[model samples]
Target: MNHKYIAFETIVIKEIRRFARIWLQTLVPPAMMIGLYFVIFGNLVGRRIGEMGGYQYMEFIVPGLIMMSVIQNSYSNVVSSFFSHKFQHSIEELLVSPVPNYVILCGFVAGGMARGLGVGIIVTLMSLFFVDLAIQNLAITIAVVLLTSIVFSLAGFINALFANSFDDISIVPTFVLTPLIYLGGVFYSVELLPPFWKFVSGLNPIFYMVNTFRYGILGTSDVDIVWAFLILLLFITLLYICCIVLLRRGTGLRS
Candidate 1:
């Protein structure tokens, strides 16, 4: 095999195996959390919350929960995995090798997508245990899910590049990612929000993601579904360009 191909294959495979080797950390906990959310929020609190957009609260929020797992896991996978390589100084080995930066970037992003999509699938299956799902549009469902994964994976790559310490790896997820996901129409419809907050929430990227997927699943949405796909594609391309530039410049790669 060509050296670049070998490196790409090795790096991607290593990333995949890393998660597989620790299924407990990578997979089980998220699935269990999904189950808990269904029980606590969907069954209990959701009953009091009543119907949203014509569906039960549990059904209403399933798309958001799935999108949330997809976003968090995808982003976390690349940030932690790539940053670990940097921390161990192994990135230097690849940087000095013949592998193109693009290959390296794709390999890690591929790994992140794998973890993200894996979690989404697991969450979706778990959601079935709570209520029957109605997938209104298959194409929209897959497109939005894939786009959400790609965007967040790139976000994770950028964060990993900027991260200097273990704590640095978490700042984006803690401060930025969490708030965005929560306020992204997970529990309440934006229609019920104050006019000012409604306009502000419109700017939330996750809102489009969850809304588009919700439209696909339940045939109900707050935003134009086409706009959601366009927004996600725009972010994906922009983020990919940024990650490529950072890899070429070796930003934060050296001590």
Candidate 2:
């Protein structure tokens, strides 16, 4: 086997083991929180909302909730794990080693994707208990979820690189990611918003992701599918380049 492949595999396996060893901390909390969303928002509040985007309130929100779980898990996994490596000073060893920067980056991102998709599957199963799910476009559903995970994973890696402390790892998710997820049409359609708010929502990348995933499952979205794909791809490219550049420059790693 190639040495590069070995290095990549080692990093990925280490990351997977790190989370798997703490399944309760890494996995269970998200499932439980999403379950609360279903019970409170989907059952209690949905009864009154009637319908959204021409689907039952519960059904309409299921995809968004699942996507939300995926996004949160993916972003959190990388940011926390990579930052922990930095905090422990283990990352310095990898930086000085022959393992390619992109390999290290992909390994962390792939691990994050695994956890994100794993939680996504668990959330989807949980959602089935409340509402029947029928994939409107299987291809689109898979593509959107995978792409969204990659985008957030890369974003998390960037956050990890720049993170000065544990608190720094959290600021993005608390202040930035949470607000975006809520306003990202996870619960309501952008069409229902006034023209001004609708335009504002359009500027939110999460809006496009949530709607695109919703479209994959429900065949409806407030944003164009083409534009959403473009955004996901664009973010992945830019963020990946940024991660590599940071690695090569020894940002956060050297200091």
Off by over 4 Å in 1: 1-6
Summed backbone clashes in each candidate are 0, 0
Native-referenced Cα lDDT, model 2: 0.95
- With candidate 2 superimposed using the best TM-score fit, by how many Å does residue 53's alpha carbon deviate from the native? 0.9
Candidate 2, 1-255: lDDT as tens digits: 999999989998999999999999999999999999999999999999998889999998999999999999999999999999999988877988899889999999999999999999999999999999999999999999999999999999999999999999999999999999999999998889999999999899999999999999999888899999999999999999999999889898885
Winning candidate number (lDDT): 2
lDDT of 1 by residue, 1-255 (tens): 788778878888999999999999999998888889889999999999999989999999899999999999999999999899999988888888788988989889889999999999999999999989989999999989988998999999999999999999999999999999999998779999999999999999999999999999999999998788889989999999999998878799954
Location of the lowest summed lDDT over 10 successive residues in candidate 1: 246-255
Give candidate 2's TM-score: 0.98
